[model samples]
Target: MDRQKYTIALLGGTGAEGSGIALRLARAGHRVIIGSRDADKAARACSELAGLAPGAALSHDANPEAAAAAQIVIMTVPHAGQQKTVQEVREQLAGKILVDATVPLVPPKVARVQLPEGGSAVAAVQRLLGDAVRVVSAFQNVSAHHLRDLAHVPDCDVLVCGDDPEARETVVGLAADMGLRAWHAGAIANSAATEALTSLLIAMNMRYKVPGGTGIRITGLEETAEARRT
Candidate 1:
């Protein structure tokens, strides 16, 4: 699980999804930095995570600093705050991989698919960041509830989408390190599909009364030899 360890930062790391991801990354032996608008809140979250996974090499900082320090930065903020958060860290994110887990779920009608004007949220981020930053889309469909429960292996796979093959594969590896099967799901534009699935999954969760939330899985594909290395 510790293969090619990296210093990863979780922007908006004080949130539920961000905390869960931070825990898993720390457990995978990556140097995990929890980032938040409030530096104190970020540190508190790190302390709590350190208690949950002792000696996990966890730390915290304000979002901008976290982005500057890490090789890879993940945005776990809500759709409403996505643009602002990315803009705040834009300078720091240059020449680094920005993993965006943003889902466009307009409140009150969250179960209904509500894509942004540009068709894909990650694509917008990519355009905003330009070519210097490799923006990869992922984790929009993963259940944050199950992610926090380390004992439970999530019964779902991750669909990683990015224009850059190397950056996309890097995220696939990170997902694997977190103990979940991940696949390269074409380019970042395909993120619209994955983002929409979150709403569909939410609808299903309510209809089926699934407590931990529903997730998507890809069937029938065998792992390639290269995938096995990661």
Candidate 2:
């Protein structure tokens, strides 16, 4: 299958994860719109990214406008702000894929896994967005710092979870485009496992002092046809 190109709206694109992913997406030849509550901040981020990758298609807009313009919307906001950002763009997100990268890590005790009432951050987003929008959860285990440093390939596997099979495949392809291996980790509800794994990784980072960042990779499947093809 030919990789489907998408105009992606990155909500909270002024932040670390959002900007890092935006940079990768832009470099991969996808049109990226940095979306933020502050349009100026989004524009500034876009400018900085443009400098990093000379001729990439990068732009900015307020959350609503960006969401409206894009075919795929990625939510990278903190857990506290995820709902508000999602609500802001709710109307514009219908019939689109919304990749939820929000992990529920209550600060100070961020090392201790803390899942929301709905099981995971993505679950809450799915509830808020309803059936009109397809929600795929991923990137919780990735290090934003690693993503920003395009020179180094991240040694991590992205666990993509979504109720919709096609949506999951789309996000997996996006992760692959960024040079990261991704696996379909079943339905959106399974996102809780991946989200909780972030805290475990944080704990491991501090406990063992892994410099850049620690990541997870699935093993024992090297002989599979899918793995061989990749």
Candidate 3:
């Protein structure tokens, strides 16, 4: 993959997660398009991301146009809005990768899992996009708070899953560029498990007041000294 030769579009780019991803991608030298339902909001976000990475070559547009302009589209909209966002840009997403960052957090009692139909956001996107778009799931458990810092983001692991290997690799590249450890967690069906972990993490966060929250690390998966000796 050419480090300086890709264009990424972030749908719902006005939000913290979306804008942060846009900012980091822009800093990485990709042509980034900040997309929103409101054209003005997208424009403002592009300006903000530009400040984060000077001469980042970011642009702004309504959802459809933004998706059309970029080779990859990222759906960072809230769960409630995720389906609609995908539908709105579906026509423009044919043969492109759609990175889904939506978590099903239904207001008030968000600590409880509230998964959508099809079991996960990526599944919902795959359904909506049919075979036209390659849906890849990622960033569900990631904290929006980290992306807000343009200077640096907390060390985090991202589990990227999709049926299409190309799509999964594309998202993994983006994750790596953002200073994250990304693992290919099998197909899009596995996304249901990954998304559920976030709600469980939220409950842990409330109970322990752990500011940064909990992240899963596979024990013994790392080649520790004890394992190496065996």
Candidate 4:
């Protein structure tokens, strides 16, 4: 499959996880707009990423403008701000693939599984955006430390979930572009499992004393991995 380059907007892209994601996307030859609540902050992030991904098409904007201008919008906001951010950019999200990477970790107790009322954070995004938006859940378990390191191909897998099969495939391809294995993990509701796994990974990271943060690899998929390499 030929890879398609997209203009991707990472909302709340000023943060560590968001910036790391933007860097990978920009390096993959996709145009990346780092979106933040403050335009200056987003611009600063873009400048920093430019050095990391030299000659990569990278820019910045306030979240709403970024969301409106991009082919795909990725939500990387903190769980506390997820709802407000989505509501602010709701109109711009229509007819676009909205990838929700929001993990509902309630701070200090982040190691404990604390799923929201709907069970899945991305599902809440889907409900908020309605049918006009193709909301896909991904990147919940990818470590920022791994993504920021250009030489490091994350020893992990991305489980993409969405109500739309095509949208899920698009995200799976995007993950491939980041040099990671990804799979269609079924409907949007299935995202609850992946989202909840973030907390478990956190617990394991602490218990095992792994500095780069622990990640997941789906076992017994050698054939799938081989097919991708062919």
Candidate 5:
């Protein structure tokens, strides 16, 4: 699996989700490129990322450069940075699959689900990028803490929603590579439901004693010849 044809580019890779994914891919023997707004930050993070997977082709580059170098781009930045980030790297993202993991978490009252005026972050990205980029929404339900520890495969499913079937499939494959179970959650608008579920899960976590805990189990499937052998 490490011999995957292309590298995973993580924009805003210094952030929790982005960095966690970078490590996850590295552990899985896949090439990963961490993109940062600051060149110096990328340089520092790249060194640590390389340490995670010895001799792994892991490196850091500026957002645009990383986008250009990778086949798939996962945007792990916050909702606040989505538009500007896309605009800045729009040229590099052309014809690329851009996974949007943004959640509209209005900090002070994030306990409640808040859909933005743009409907959903996935829709917002589609609107902002037009046809230049293929945006897929995913990874909104998992905690960054769990993703970083490659030893623990969280019992969560990644809800991948996007207009482009190829892009969605690419993300699903990438999710599997990262030890995640990804589901095609329909068109980008469906992201509104999945993104909202994040808060519901968080509220449940708060009520319970489970810290940074949330998971989904796909029932009705037993270990068989056709299923993925764990």
Candidate 6:
């Protein structure tokens, strides 16, 4: 199957995770718009990313404008700012796919699993944006450091979860474009597991003192038809 290109807006794109994903998507021939609370910050990020991936389509705007211009919107802000960022673009996000990569990791004890009252960050986004927007949760386990260094293909699998199967598949395709295997991990409710896994990976990174990013890979099902379909 041919890869489907998209105009993706990365909210909080000035940050490491958002900018890294934007660079990868742009390098894969997608038009990427870096969005941030400050337009100047977004522009600076776009400029820096363009240097890394020359000739890749890249642009920048405020969060609302970027969200309105893109086919898909990804929120990569820290857990504390997720709600505010999503709320700013909620109106522009109707009838679009909003990829929530925000993991609820309360700082001081980030390594410890500490999910919000709603179970996961994705669920909270769903409640805020309602059904009009397809909120797919993913990219929680991958590391920003690894994503920024595009020289090496990541040794990780993205666990995508969403209420809509088609939405999940679309995100899986995006992951594939970044050279990572992605799987449909059931409904949006299942996002809790992946979100919690980020904390575990953080703990492991500290425990083992792994300089590079430590990630997870699903084994024993590589040959499955379903896996290939993704």
RMSD of each: 1.3, 1.2, 3.8, 1.3, 2.3, 1.1
Q: Residue 154's C-alpha lDDT in candidate 4?
A: 93
* Predictions in order: lDDT: 0.91, 0.91, 0.80, 0.91, 0.81, 0.91
lDDT of 5 by residue, 16-88 (tens): 7888888877777777899988988887777877776678778888888888998888888887788888888
Candidate 1 lDDT tens digits, 1-230: 45799999999888988999899989989999998878778888999999989989999988899999999999999999999999999999999999999898999999999999989988999999889999999999999998899998888899999999999989998998888889999998999999999999999999999999998888767666755665
| Candidate 3 Cα deviation (angstroms), residue 91 | 0.8
Q: Which scores greater on lDDT, model 3 or model 6? A: 6
Off by over 4 Å in 2: none
Off-target runs (Cα >4 Å) in candidate 5 are 1-3, 221-230
Evaluate residue 81 in candidate 4 and report its C-alpha lDDT on the 0 to 100 scale. Answer: 95
Two-way TM-score contest, 4 vs 5, winner: 4
For candidate 6, the per-residue lDDT at 138 reads 93
TM-score, candidate 1, is 0.96
Stronger candidate by lDDT (5 vs 6): 6
lDDT of 6 by residue, 119-197 (tens): 9888988988789999999999999988989899888889999999999989999998887789989999999999999
Local accuracy of candidate 2 as per-residue lDDT tens digits, 102-140: 989999899999898878889878887789999999998
- RMSD after Cα superposition, model 4: 1.3
TM-score of 4: 0.97
Error of 4 at 220 (Å): 1.2
In model 6, the runs with Cα more than 4 Å from the true position are none
Which lDDT tens digits does candidate 3 get at residues 184-212?
A: 78889889988888899899989999786
